[model samples]
Target: MRDVAKVFDRTGSTLGVMDDLQVALHTYDGCSRGCAGCVVDKHFKNNWRFRNIMTGPDMRIVGERVKEYFHWIQENLNTKSDGYFGTNGYKVDHYSYTFRFGNHSELPQDMLEEIAESCPSDFRVFSTAPSDEIHKFVDLRRTHPGNYFLEIIYDPVADRAQDIRDMVLDMRSNGILGYPEVLITQRLLQAYSPERFVEEALGPLGDIGTQLQLGRYTPSKTRGFRTTQVVSVDEEVRWMTAVAKGIVDRKYDIHPIPIGEYAVTFLDEYKEAGYEGPDGYIDVARLPEPEPFNIANVVKKTRDIFLSSIYVDHNLDLHVWSESMGQHVLDRNFGFEPLGNVRNRPIHEIVTEPNGVLERMLREVVRNLATHPKCSGCRYKSFCASHAIPLFRKWQEDDGEHCYGYLPVIREFQKDRPFLTNMIDGFKELGF
Candidate 1:
């Protein structure tokens, strides 16, 4: 029952930081967290097999498909018709996605009490599990307080430092709320020492409120045949600018998170079942060499080009996300299938289907980027001609290679978020 709490809207320059509609609910079907940079074992290696476990008739078919898709999104997309977010005046409202909505694994306490009692929004429960499977979900913070959080990952080349100091002292002794994602590889930026990893793994969680984040370690691929580990957006922007300079010489007051651009597929049923991946010709010779396109990475690459996200999977299929063209997450299917079936139509007429197909592939990606030519000399070409130039021409027609690896970490994340480059140059003067 994925995208159960389904909602929409996520177009250009994140329409001023996503103004409404965004639910995202998921129960779990696989993912036992065999994390070796798990992008679902780099796209289900050897045809899937790293699951967690859930039984009881898989929690009664995930509580009858999440209460029948949240009763068909409160009886069909909660009102206001003829989309364009209701005649372009926008104000939709749906919220609820405060942290994990599945996929980083570890929730099974009866699937977190059937997503905190048959979902209805208000989420937050990401984990990595340790302190004894997170002290059996600490009675979900006395049954869900400030929505329950954990987020901990800190894999300095495969986690340890005493299992991240006993899961941050069993999440500050169960009071919970203890964020810290930190991944940055290349063997943690050439064997990161950062003063014994900030003096014995982030100085014994001093803050008690941890917020670090800092991510990166993408590179996945696996379907039919198998094996694909290409790399080159100039060596993942020099290993994400040497792990954002080891989280700034251990100054450690982090919050980077931007790692976008990764499309290199090459299928043909993994080449008529011969299979032998790797080597993606320098991601097709650095796709027209662009990067360094300022205006602060247009809302993290326009949230992977105009595809705001929706995601409901476990056979209730509805998807809508659209980024990650490669390293396969089913290439973020926005439409080529399942624009319906929330257990039989009516998710607002399968998202306003006026000859739909994701509205003619988002209006032919603005008439193929207003008639391309390497999108008129890049410079964030009109926000990638209204959203990632038709996802880089379908990642060069699925021969794949579009990983711009966030252009060498957007000049060190516009030097500590310089007001997010004036709100991405004020949405490129309203032409987003």
Candidate 2:
């Protein structure tokens, strides 16, 4: 059995801890789209000047490296006698990996096929811009079909709606096995109200079994340069809740990513509180405002935010996470530097070496969570630790302020708890 860590709140009540690891592979670093508010654009642009571009053969080599790394992890780390404890002193029991062929650039067909051939078992995600080449993905799916998903980055400001609809329709017509994931950034949410977005965008795509991911735009020095276009926490909450309600309504075959994850959290809190109305129904008014800084909640939120994920960028540089890939670009001494480039050394050597950079940084992040005044007192400290730690380290400011955003959505769901609960139950009954 895997050793489990006990997470406690300020009052010493027990909280749940996570025990899984995820690896994100970035195969390329140059994108031609030049979409608005691209999180990796600046980093990619900077690296393009100095970094060697990865060719198809280079990607295959990376694929082999990743496979060897995973085998080493399973043989050495994921054992009863030698469990892996990487994040905040939490032990991880299982490991899963995601391969994103083009984290920064649009994936070419040859590179996409190389990834497909290299990692046949792993869940492979190809990020590409809106182009006629997207149709080639259908053939890839037909030839090699496992946990493969194509993520189409749709910049509502720059891309046309018809293009998306046409591409999805083409995939369906060609007998593509699974739906392609579409990414809509915060700018689109700001441009169109949640209701309007659902009616105009999500509605058509959802009917076709396309999964939509709402990308939250955070103000980073490199990405989201157009600060004026960023949406507020309130607006984000509105969009998320509306989309979740749509899922509960069975309006589409689409599955909400983080929204569903958030729903599970809110559901747990609702059940634990046991608040009910006169008719034994959930009373939204009776629900208490969540204590974001409560130690147990903070730990759980940090676990959720982190998802025990690590990133390997195009240069074969291992980052703490995908978001941290650009930390050096933001500030050279951001502290969360790449663990070590895989090109120079094997991943196992870099990760398993005693007191290595990765371990030291993990300890440092946990220490900061406990000692940093802003983090110790702030409501969204967990988020700051897990998602925005690099930004926080650079600015010495709280980036987790948006932690409160989940409350409004929870409250809204509570208003229709019975129906929503029944819908979730029905989903289970149908084996979803």
Candidate 3:
């Protein structure tokens, strides 16, 4: 297995050389929040409440299975043969592995503890509401002491502002929450004013040891209730412009997730242009906004989106991507079938086997993306290829109406170049 991994690494194949593997685990069967237009609920054939939930003992078994896979990966995939210069001009010695829990359902303490102990590495815990269980996470952090993230999903319509604020404060008091480690995610809905979203949803949070993630609502076939909530490209561009302007004008202390990333990209471009001022300090305000360029080129230069990450549902079914699992549940014909269940097969076999089902499917997906006429000329091709299968499926289902979900945001970045430049300058001035 090690020899096979070395070969794949040398060839620059996406299969074997993996620096990070994000395994998203659905801990529970049903959610208690019952928020309207829940994506998780749409994954089920019937009501989520009717599904059989995994018990603590069942979760423990799953944890052991994951631990076994992790150990196998550590032994076989973590090291490279000496004197072998692989792709990217480096030898693999160590990599990070993460277990992301409670993405779709509420995770109980017992389940959390079992998974935490089993993995004994970096992990993320998520919650939709304020709970007494926050303390238990703090306790677990003390014992484990690994790089951890606590994600809180705040729905402006469903959750009270004070309740979420109080929860974050409690976590901060316990020394469990900090910048980049604590994330507050709010969904972007259609017709919601970008200014209003910042004022109502983000304003009250007020730099409470948390970063922000603006989640774009994806239209799901099963959940027609949210179909109207899908933001159009125009609206998405407006949202990005508004956020960038807000960051510059209001000087919000919080760092918005991808917006911060985009600002850094622009800043790097500014530096590369040799725009240094007196004393080697570049005057940001004096510099013009970056010219409109393909954001995909930037993404392609940075990293390959096709990293070795997999998803495992509560049923122990392993998938190529986390989004694939949702497609499988919503509509099997449109979905990429699971490579295999972890309960039945080992992780290495499912991922690394030559001429295997997984490899064949991945190759086909890549070929389709690389050959598609729309994708061939598109600026977002590189970024789109990272999520080729499901996105391709959606394009087919929509009769090629949807070019890419993020086109509006990308266009906005180009259209409002001055605002983006100002935002980058503002972040630089604030020492972000």
Candidate 4:
């Protein structure tokens, strides 16, 4: 019941599946460590740092099929781990997590060791912010390779600086499993310049983290928090450069889960033979060879300024996108010009894991960049290329995987409004 097939725009038919038990508990939504501005923590306010160790909150588990597994999942649910479906049938997306020993009084080292040893599946994941645990997880990965994986989640801004450094040290201590996965927040990346963020991102931790998800906020499903936050392109560029510099300096063994920035760099170089622009779309011949890092830079720079410009009041122009950013994905992946050699199926999609919702979304977006105004062909394509559907959700709201945030950012810097904007303004001006 935890396995649900979600259709992606790029891939007409595909199944998205995750081991319900591991995925749910592993993805910490409720953390009461009181880390200011932690996205998951803020969204689900609970004291997970010092987890109850005895009882979980009342929030419904993600994979729960209200009509189907409610009673089943609830009966076996261990409120202690915030667990559901302990007794459920063979969990496909089985997960395993490890917490740092000795930090929280709730679950002692004995408990963590026992969990690691008794890992239900051949492949398990360990999520930790503690330094020792990070090293241990890496050690385990060395001994177990792809059978078990490690996901590190230490936010520099959320927790103390020492804590983050300690965690990075642990990753460096064990270089076997590549980079220790760490979560770098927009807040941290923005507060400090991208150079600083990269220094930390590329510090001892090797690969920064599994996913570097960046985006604005929507009204939290949990109330009392208001106001949406957004990041622009320039902010992201600085962030990437900082990371690139880190790679150059630290010699960190970095790996991308979806091959994020790496993929962008590769695809951008190959865009020349592929791009089929709309009528007024600028020709490659008319402009400078698009910078490989231009899009990444814009996203980082714009993001940093937007996130940090807390006092700026440029409520100038706002535009919204439709449907989880489908426009961008569609253009890049599936559709062909019917006049060119572009195949109906995108090149990347051929190699994608059908179970991958994120990959499917990426292809669809690259497919759509040409006409999705925010993309501006190559202007900010890096962010669109690097970011996933999750970013789209920032703008799409409850629209189920869409984004329009960039539309507004575009309007802010736009000295010349397009025909579409002019038409909309003229109507508003006349009160008609």
Candidate 5:
């Protein structure tokens, strides 16, 4: 029922780059899962006075906004002209969309069906539904066949871990995409007792056969009444490495997971600064390439801003990352003026307008990456150069709630390092 399609570029330009534009339409807002370490809860809600729990009827508006954007893509981006790939080129790839951004939100069944019917076969369907409704998504994929690829997140700490285990076991036994992606965070790791973690968490997948993947949880702040737990730098590396080692030593059927190499490569700047933890142990094993730590090797030519993908929030407001803070650049309200509206403007103009917010941001980002002193001398320039300025800008704007730490580039280096390392290795190019 599920399928995989190769994606080369989102802009459909003649350049043979491989960046994918993953547009996500948020079906709902406000998560009920209430994971202890969620950034939304820790930073957005507590500090910014950001309201959570926007759902139900609002999803219809999300669906409509996505439909409008999809319509625009079909009219403008998905063209029949072969010039997009040039005369000698054989394949052209369009930007793909997914209904995957928000957590603890449900989709209107009718809207899901409409999206399943409308998007290209390569469109991915990502969900984090509880175990009982997990099958509903699989069934949806079965009905749609090759139209979409299915990605489900099994949050081990989510109260339904047992149900998740049961469903994953069933899928693996029945050969249904094996086991879906399991997301284990420090929040989850610290939640369960060690004995329960081994018995309930790791025990179920003991026989899935080298098909599993160990994912590194992103660096984040866990909010507490009197203090905040900033899981950055050393902590992020340690936990991810521990998770990877745990998976490997258990003799599960997962791929190598690359946690070691990623940690090693991404921490180049830190190591250069002679930074070392109390134990002086580097969790991940290092890789040899990127010898001088070149940025060119990580990112390709086409400039990309952070959170470059398009997202339509629950309120039908189109959003993009206006700054490095990952704050929503809404097409409508929320006190901030948006770049452009999906409801009124064409897709190309919104993204490519010479003086648009995204364009200006991208320009400054590129300029800063080229000129910044630390970036000019740093080894991982390619990986962080594109958005380093905005990340710093966002940190200043938001007071470092979601951004992590006060040190200029230290937190930025640690925040998404593990994931970026895996992505860079996976794509053999820089990714954000």
Candidate 6:
């Protein structure tokens, strides 16, 4: 890892001003859908790895504990500011709950409802597998305005992809809690043609995001769980651009996070520095964001999302801009003291890196929904921050391979300018 050249004011008391009820829940074992490259696989060795929420005293205790977190949040953060309190710390392979209690038709209805009931109804997004039973839960989720969102996750190339997509669309059509997404990664795109697949499977809902976030593969899981087919940034950009354009051309639903802005912004920086292609390789000089990414010049362009209600599961630090990044930090009710620092250490390296974890983290911000680091020179010294956990979980406490798909998306989005400006805009504060 490169040395962290930039210095952060590590002096501040890491005061995390949290919201109402953003707790995190995980199975840690029992079931896994085997996402081609998953971070959860790294923790397979630990006994506590798979806590099996279905059995044991831990699950019973959690059921009650989460409720406490929820009620506490209602009084503190949710009513006014965005004090996120959602699920935290659990490396379950794929699906958390087995839903294996009764016959196929019955499913784990009662228990599932109980789990959902325990979590803060408004402000929490329950990340669940893309199962048929999800629709049932979505119906119930809609009853609560801000509490639940049926997080429908699934692979696109797999056989069940179509089934899952169909069920998701049907759910949306049926007015179910429809914040579902296609968890397609960059590596997966290499294996399959997303353009053709979206055309065939998603049909309409595929139009959700402007660019399907091209996620990267973690090193640990990369050995077996993830493929190490390292594609160059240029090619990655090409492929990502193609997929992004494909979605745009077809008018599919492509909700782009702030990372897309990063890509577009970077591209302009490269061109501004007099870039030129060499030996079939397009080259550009590096003109990184002035020493402090939080220059007033950059912040002048963005808006203030400070008052907005945001989740904080991934600990998305305010200093680090992200695609919203790999997965969102939206409402996860989890413990804070343990997951303080992001797994990706040495923030200095990550901010200006070329291809390592820092670059990837930046890529996530550019491609997805990102919050800019307008805090550099601002006097609003009391405001707290968050960082995406998937990319930095190990640094805090060794765990999973779930955050590697943002690299390509970052490279791709680096070409756009308007997107870049949008991202930079988030940095500026009212007082500044």
Count of residue pairs whose backbone atoms collide, per candidate: 3, 1, 0, 41, 7, 90
Model 5: lDDT of residue 47: 36
Give the runs in model 5 whose Cα sits over 4 Å from its true position.
1-20, 30-32, 39-95, 101-108, 114-121, 147-153, 158-162, 169-186, 192-203, 206-229, 248-251, 255-308, 315-338, 367-374, 386-432
Residue 262 CA error for candidate 6 (Å)? 5.3
Give one digit per residue, the lDDT tens place, for model 5 in 1-432.
002122222132221132344466543333445643343333333332212233434544444545554555454443433322223222224455555433422444555555555444444545444445445455666766643333445566764545655765555443344234544455665665544654576666555432233433333322322213323434444444444445444544433222323233335423422333344333223423334633342232223333335665444455563222222332332223455655555545576676776655555555655665545544454545432333343322322222222222222223333433333343331111
Name the better of 1 and 2 by lDDT: 2
Tell me the tens digit of each residue's lDDT in model 1 across 162-237: 6666675676577655555665445554565544555555555433323445543444332222223223345555
TM-score between candidate 3 and the true structure: 0.65
For candidate 4, lDDT tens digit of each residue in 1-432? 123231112122101112232221222333334332333433223545434231222112111212122233333332212112133322222222222211221344444444444333344444443445554455455544534333444455654444554555455455523223333335555566655655654454444332222323333333234333333334443444345444434544433222232232222333422332354332446444655544333333222211111110011111111122211111111221111111232212222236443334434555555445445544446444433333443333323222333322222112112322222222221110
How many backbone collisions does model 4 have? 41
Candidate 6: list runs displaced more than 4 Å.
1-22, 27-32, 39-107, 138-147, 160-165, 179-187, 193-204, 207-214, 219-237, 257-324, 328-337, 340-432
Task: Name every residue pair that clashes in candidate 3.
Answer: none
Cα RMSD of all models vs. native, in order, equals 19.5, 7.5, 9.2, 18.7, 10.0, 13.4
Tell me each candidate's TM-score: 0.31, 0.66, 0.65, 0.41, 0.56, 0.48
Model 6 Cα displacement at 184 (Å)? Answer: 5.4
- Model 1: ten consecutive residues of lowest lDDT: 261-270
Regions of candidate 3 where Cα sits further than 4 Å from its true position: 1-19, 42-52, 55-65, 71-108, 142-147, 178-191, 206-209, 219-228, 262-307, 322-334, 355-357, 372-374, 378-380, 387-432
Judging by TM-score against the true structure, name the best candidate.
2
In terms of lDDT, the best-performing candidate is: 2
Descending-TM-score candidate ranking: 2, 3, 5, 6, 4, 1
